[model samples]
Target: MLLKELVDTAATVAATRSRLTKVEALADLLRRLPADEIAPAVGFLVGRARQGRVGVGWRQLSSVMGEPADAPTLTVADLDALLDRLLTTAGSGSAALRSTALRDLTSRATADEQDFVGRVLIGEMRTGALEGVLLDAVARAADAPGDAVRRAAMLTGDLGETARLALVDGPDAVAAVGLQVGRPVLPMLASTAADPASALEVTGEASVEWKLDGARIQVHRRGDDVHVYTRSLADITHRVPEVVDVVRSLAVDDVILDGETLSLDEDGAPRPFQDTMSRFGADAPRETLLRPWFFDVLHVDGRDLLDEPLSARLAELERVAAEHRIPGEVTADPAVAERVSREALAAGHEGIVVKGVDAPYAAGRRGKSWVKVKPVHTYDLVVLACEWGSGRRQGWLSNLHLGALDPQGEYGEPGGYVMVGKTFKGLTDELLRWQTEHFQSIETRRTAHVVHVEPTTVVEIALDGVQRSSRYPGGIALRFARVKGYRDDKRPQDADTVGALRALLPGA
Candidate 1:
């Protein structure tokens, strides 16, 4: 199929607010794609390239200046092939070669296609073809059960591959996708609650576990081989040999465990989050030994427990890795839940997560079955732009223009971010210097004082609460907002939404 065809379909999807309309448009488009183009087309619609991070930054992309093709001729496969070439083009002078190739490709694309390609390359495609809507569209196009498609996608951790399987190989092939011992599945997420008592009200007879302020890790072990994946499912096994050793020592031959890992000081207190992430993101493991603490087990031996209740999974978790199990208590009493929360907080952990004892594992879904409570109001928000610093902090990016995701376009474009507030507080000189260099690398455009960037960086912000205001497009601004840190583990799409922020309004 032509790239224009996909671009036009994305436009159609973006022009409407009804999810049904978006799904129908994307389904129609998906039905017409050839087998070879299914994955690439899905990736383009979702604003992710098949070749992740092709070394083409905004600077390189802006360097390409050429006239667009008058007519539609570029195919989806052609664009995918070009991205593949760009991914593999690395060495001295590789930048020049990649730029030349990008120019050649853009020169052949029409104006709309150029814009679409640029957005896709920079991870800014906001056509409302969200993964959830696109998954529904894939099911619609394939005439498969939506639940089955969703389950397959969650199990495989690859929507593009799931789309290809469902569309090309039929629903049976999609159904055949199952939990692999080596591959990583999407980690389950939790909703936020005011406190453990509030969370327990939502989840009766709950397991209140410590909410650690550390990196999320998913460990999959088969025989002696172990793999560690981050929240986004990127493998960091080589960077965390300590975690590998822990997983390998588990009693079970094959298992899938979800937990957190962090560096601890001599006092057994968790190190600063940045310290852990710095070691986590390193190319080689450092002397800081990360200890693993398993909270839930999804698979054991040859049996899959994803469909099992939390009680059952925790039983299995305790049986195999009791020593590594995160501290928690299973109770229906609100007082006990509060005690656990207090204990967790007193121990320097974040707070507690109250999980329903009867709820099955809902991978990639943030439903009310699990709720987290912390004393401070913290949110993961996107950095929309950065202001040039002044005075003593001159020449650095100091103030951050923060935005919350607006999935339904209630205040702006669908799937785009609505600016909530700005903050120059809580940033150390190191962060200011780092962001000054980093933001420019991903900078989309700039003014004399502000540098606008692609909405991609995710930063954790602590706030007193949100107050209604007309100063921003979202009609709510973060009160007393300050940066906790940059969440290198989160993606822009994973940031909290505008609705979530509005839910914090007084009497809400």
Candidate 2:
């Protein structure tokens, strides 16, 4: 199939707000795809490369200043082969080779095709047809049950392959995809709750466990071979040998354990999340080592626990990783939930997760089966700038750039503020209007996407916690930050400080 056809369909998908339209367009595109092209087609539509992060960065892409062809000539297979060469091109003159390859590819593409290619290469499709919508499209095209398709994709952690199997081999083949010992499946996620009592009220008889502020580790063991994957399913087995050794110590011949890993202080308390990420993201040697704390087991000794209830999974977890199991209790009592939450916080952890005892793990989806409770921290932070919103809020200053005062010059100049993050959450149309008008009055400078304003406006922001940041000057950034409301009465200097945020760091 032509790359232009796919790019045109992506534009149509993005132009419509109706999911039904997106699904229909995608399904039509899928029906036209030959079996050999299914994976790359699906990958491109979903804004990912089948080759995966082919050593291309925005800087390299920015260098490809080519005049796009007025006509379409690139094929889907053509782009795929180009990506293959880009990924494999390396050695001394590799930089020049990459530049040449990118230039040639872009020069052959039309303007729209160039935009599509850029978006796919940068990993931001923005077509409104993400994995969820694309999964529906695959199911529609294959005439298969959505659950079967979703389960196959979830278990294999490869939506593109799932699409190929569902289209080429039929429903049974997709259904045949199951939990394997070494291949990482997508980790089940939790929804947020106001408190432990609220969380327990939703889950009933539950397994409440510490929600550590650490990297998620999915440890899979088959015989002596063990692999560790992150929450996003990236294998990081070589980064932490200690975890591999611990899983290898397990007597079970084959198993998959879901847990968190972080480096703790000498007192056995969890260190700041930055310290954990520093070690997790590093490829170099470090003195600090991460320790794993298992909370659930998906497989044990070849028996699949994925379809089993949480109670059963916990039992298997206890049998396999009892010593490393996170501190928790099984109860329906709110008092017990509250106590466990307090205990977790007292232990220098972030929060607690309450799991329904009878609920099976719903891989890759955030269902009501699991709920996480954490104290919300809100601060009157200054708005450094605002970005032009997209979609419904287009032309409005929607995303607020947030900053924290650094009075002591700990992060930057004395008496100035350091940027922590940006968020457009919790904004109503009324708020957007107010910000658009208000920010323009104090606008100091402007860019195509951002309106820089004098840091005089104070807005209240809420977040889950903070993480260590190399991008921000303060060496920290807010996690899950959202705007609460504008604090009209507060001055910029009266806003929260970097020190105040650092105090929220675990074990601080």
Candidate 3:
């Protein structure tokens, strides 16, 4: 199919708020695509490249200028092949070569197609539909159950390939997709509750495990061969050899373990979240070592435990890798849940995750089968600035720039606010209108995208925790932060200090 046809379909999907309409439009587009073109088309429509990050930065894309074609000629396969070539050319003069390639490719696309291609290349193709909606659309187009498509996508770890299978080879082929020993399956996620007792109430009989403040890893092992992936399913086996070695040493010949990994201090306590990230994010190994703690086993001894309940999976995990299992116990009593939560918090860990004993794994989703209970930390922070909104939020100041007071002037002037993070979540339309009108009164300066305001307005912000960072002046960044409400009664001096924010850092 022509690139313009896909681009037009994407526009239609974005224009509709009704999910059914979006699914119909996408399904129609998928039906028109050739079997070989289905995977690339699905990837492109979902704002992803089939080959992952193509090493093409914004600078390279913007550097090459090409005139739009008057007719539709670029096919989905054509662009995919062009990207494949671009990925191969590297080293000296590779930039010029890539630029030429991009120019040649763009010159063949019409104006709308060019816009779509540019957005796809830069990772800016934000339509309402992503993987979830597209997965449903694939099922609709193939006349298959949604669960079948979801399971195939999760097990294979590739929605694009799953789309091709469902559209081309039929439902029987989609059902055939299963766990491979060395390929990571999507990690199951948890929804949040107020506390352990509250979570246990929701899950009935449950296992309360210590929720560590670290990276989530899915390890797949087949004898000596082992592969590790992040929560987002990016392969990081090269960066974490120790993890690979540990998985390889497991008694089971083939197993897929879902767990957490973090660095521990000399005292055996978990290191700061940043310290673990410092090692995990590095291209080369750091002095800090990562220890794996398994909570659930997806596959064991070539038997798939993903369809099995949590209790069965835990039993399998104990028999296989009991030495590496996370601390927890199974109980229906809320009192027991509370005690476990206390133990987890006292150990300097984040909190407890109460999981249903009878619940099977629900991968690629945050379902109610499990609930995470963590203490909420709220602070009164000063408003540093606000940024212009986009799409539905246009004409309103949507994203807030939050800063913590620095009383000691450790990172800035005494009594001045130091930048910490930005958040656009938990804001209502009324709140946006209020911000746009109120912030302008204290405006110190203005830019195309942002309005600098006097750090006088204090707002109540709630965050999960803080992580060490070089991006902020205070050397820490807020995690999962959102506005609770404007603290109109509070002054800038009454705002929380940077030290107070840093104190929330886990294992700090």
Candidate 4:
């Protein structure tokens, strides 16, 4: 497909405010694309190189600049050298320099590169601005039903492939392809039931399994080799070696198991979510210190259980886990989960996830089929000066007049104490006392009502609820928000942005 064709499609989607218009535009593009150009066509739609998901990093625009430290100093020096030129010179401020840069960028950049630039300038990078909406567009373009495209994309996670089947084969193409061997199925997740009655109504006669407080992992083992992926499907096999050992110990020669990877303390209780997340950072040791507990199996020996009922799959999971002594379960009773949750909380672990006993793996979604009920506490808050945050928050100072940023946006705007928010929920009382002293130093003005600070100090802010408010411009107000502590490790510009504040939608 031509680059202009894809650009037009993306631009059309972005310009159209309604979902209906976006879908129609996307479908129109798909219908017009030649069959042979399907893969490239989707590539155009994504404004990315045509590469498999497993190999997307090198295809990334920034990745084209080169690896960190090794990356170019003045300009992006690799495949994105052209892009670097556009970005570096795009902001000369000097009209002549700006004109030259724009001219050069126009001549040097590809059609897709132009689209990327347009999106970056506008702060909307992903195709159609939303993945779900775009996926629907791809289906419509192919003249296929949305369900078919959703299933294909969910199973494969390859928008390009999904686009292909949706365009050419229409809906039902996924089912017609027979079972995909080696292709991973999307894993299922848990949801929360408003109450026990609702939970029971949905479960019917099915069983409920306790959702453990741990990271979700997809375990793939074939023969003696094993691979593990995080919920985002990032390859983490090397980071969690203990999981590999467990899979190797499994009875089946080749099996794909769905489960959780959690850091269990010495007392056998899960650790903090932050701790679990931090374990796989850039600085984490490339060793298997994490533990993985198996819960379900979606594939075994090339046979797909995706269409199979949970009851049958549970039997398989039970047999394999038991035969191999892998940590997993098959019983639907909530008692085991209740015990797990109680024990987990006693040991400072997060609450449990209750899963459906018969649901197929519904990857890329969160619904009642899989339920999660975590215990979160709330605190009361007092409104301070509200300012904009950075990046997406440049004009609004959206960050809470946060007591803190790394500076959570408590900077002094011209007329008032404009700050985003502040927080260091990890700190102790000692930190809070230290923050008050530091905040006093930055004080520019003070009143009986509000103490105007220089925005130099930031204190951590924590709250439980948000209510509609005339107090804030975003049409909402914070509840139980106050300084938990402070973080001096960050700068004020590094504070939260207005975008973050908007994310606190009630239902969301």
Candidate 5:
């Protein structure tokens, strides 16, 4: 298939912002792909392609393709060619190409359609939902089982492999998919609900395990061999070797356990997220130095226990993780979750992910079934020009330039707004490194952490509150709006709309 056709389909999907349309676009793109290339293509889209991390953005892709110019230009056909190069290199390209390839495409996008294509390429394809929300759409389009297909893709990080197995070997391959990698069927990932009332309704129980804020690790054991994967299931067997040895020394032989791995000091105090992130960023992560706290279990003794309820699995995980478990842990009832949450925060974690004992493992699903109760604060802000980022974050143009919302158009200068603040906070350093590289690529001028881009990526920013200010584009300032992480699950258009800003004023 021609690259233009793929772009057109992508454009159609973005234009409609319909899940069905996006799935159809993916289906069309897959049909044109050779059987062998399908997995690589999907993996490239959803799974990241970075060293130590999963994404290096377009620059990495461009470098992989050997595109001319420090920053390359990409045509639609360029994506397929780019994928071919990535697969040929096994996605092991110099940093330059991978970063440029995605950005170059994003740089030239003029329409909503192009933006959609760009979103998919970067794995930011959020239409107000998580990736799993679209799995059913994909399955419907491809005429396959949504659950099996999503799980297979998670295990292999390749939608094409899932498709091929479904088409060639039958549902058996899809069923046995995670097993090939020695994983039990995918483990359930948990989150927390914002409202305690909502949490009670969802779990239908007075008991739950408040979740932790850290990287999710899934450990798969085969005899003595151990492979560990992140929440996205990318193999981190090398970066987290202590985890490998920890799992290796565990009492069980064939099992898969899910847990959180935070970089903690010997005192068992949780390190700053940055310190923990730096550990992950290290080419040689000191596994012995890196502490992993096991939280849950999904498989044991060749039996699938996801259906066995959280209470049973928790017990099972503890039995296997006997030697390697994080000490002083117990199942906290729902009423005490508030107390547990205090310990999580006091220990320097974000919040807790509460899980019900009776809930089955719902792989690749996030809803009230699994809530995410992030402690958030809101701020009213005006959109300013966007900027880019670096390293693993390259080509994203993830950073933002902010100003207070100027609703009256009351500025004496160009529209009455001032650039008051800039922040790289609330983002994983992985996010930071990736954005740093991205900002560098699109930099109009450079002196330090600032690089201006087209005012294309707008966002609804939440901060602890505002402070009196004179330094930034806005005379008034946001106390902590710092990139507050990303709105990848949202479109630039969907940013907190201007009408909503009035709520911040006492006498609006």
Candidate 6:
């Protein structure tokens, strides 16, 4: 298929707010894709290239700008091959060589194709074709069940592969996809509530577990071999030997466990989140040991428990990994839920997560079946832009322009962020210095006083609440907002949404 067709469809999807229209447009495009181009086309439409990162940055991309081609001739396969070359390019003068290749590719693309390729390279699709919407489109194009497509996508952790199976191989092939022990599946996510009582109200007869402020890890063990993955499903087995050792010690021969890991001080208190992430991001195991705590079991022996209730999974978790189970209790009483929340806070943990006892694991989906409760209002927001500091803090990036996700384009572009507010508070001098350097590396454009960057960096922000305001496009502004820290573990899509912030309005 021609690149222009895909780009045109993406433009149509991004130009509207109606999800059904976006899905129909995408489905029509998907129906026309040949078997060979399905994967790359899906990846491009979703804004995530199959070749993860090709070592291309804003500086490299900017240096290779050129005039565009007049007519469309590039094919999807041609673009895929170009990405392959960029991914494999390396060594002493590889940077210059890669730039030459990028220039050649861009010189052949039209204006619209150039814009689409640039956005895809920078990891900003901004097309309303989010994974959910695209999954529905795939189902529509294949005339398959939506649930089957969703389940296959969740189990395989690859939307491109799922699309191929649904559109080419048939619905039977898509439904045949199941949980594999070694392959990492998409982890289930949670919604938020004000407190444990409120969370319990949503999830009756719940398991209220400690919500630790640590890095999320998924451990898969078969025999003595174990692989650890981050929340984004990047393999980090070699960096966390301690976690591997813990998983290896389990009695079961094969298991899949979902949990958190963090370094602890001498008194058994969890260390600062940054300290833990620093170790977690290292290529090799550091001196600081990270301890793993298992909360839910997805697979044990040869049976997959993802379709089972939480109560059944907990029983299996207790039986196999009892020593490493996170602290929690199964209760329906609100007072007990509150007690667990208090205990978690006292232990220097975040708060509690109330999970419905009867709900099956809904992988890769965030719903009310599991609700997180924290005493303070904290949200993960994207850094849209940063302002140049002044006075004593001159020459540094101080004020941060924060944005919340708008998945449905209710306020603006679909799958884009809505600016909520700005903040210069809670940033130490060290943080300011770091951001000034970091933001420049990813800078997209700049003004005299502000440096606009790619909307990828995620920072946790604490706020009193939100109030109705005409100052921002989202119809609400943050109150008393301050940075808690940068969340290196999360992606821009994982940030809280504008609707989530609006939910904090008075009498909402």
In candidate 4, what are the lDDT values of residues 119-232, reduced to their tens digit?
A: 332222344435566687786666666776777777785677777776777667754643343455556655554333345456543444445555677888878878887765
Candidate 2: the clashing residue pairs are none
Question: How do these models rank on TM-score, best leading?
Answer: 1, 6, 2, 3, 5, 4
TM-score to native of every candidate shown: 0.99, 0.78, 0.77, 0.64, 0.64, 0.98
Name the regions of candidate 2 deviating beyond 4 angstroms. Answer: 377-508
lDDT of each: 0.92, 0.84, 0.82, 0.53, 0.53, 0.91
| Candidate 3 worst ten-residue window by lDDT | 485-494
RMSD of each: 1.0, 12.3, 12.4, 11.2, 9.1, 1.1
Candidate 3's C-alpha runs over 4 A off are: 377-508
lDDT score, candidate 6:
0.91
Cα lDDT for residue 296, candidate 5 = 65
Clashes of 1: 0
Worst 10 residues of 2 by lDDT: 485-494
lDDT of 1 by residue, 172-290 (tens): 99888888898889989999998777898899999999999999999999999899999988888989998999888878899999999998999999888888888766585497888
Candidate 1 least-lDDT 10 residues: 279-288
lDDT of 5 by residue, 46-83 (tens): 42222212333433433333223333244444455544
Error of 4 at 71 (Å): 32
Supply the TM-score for candidate 1: 0.99
What is the lDDT for 159 in model 3? 88
Measured on C-alpha atoms, candidate 5 has an lDDT of 0.53
Q: Write the per-residue lDDT of candidate 6 for residues 134-193, one digit (tens) a residue.
A: 999999999999999999999988999899999999999998999898899988999999
Q: Evaluate candidate 2 by giving its C-alpha RMSD to the native, one decimal.
A: 12.3
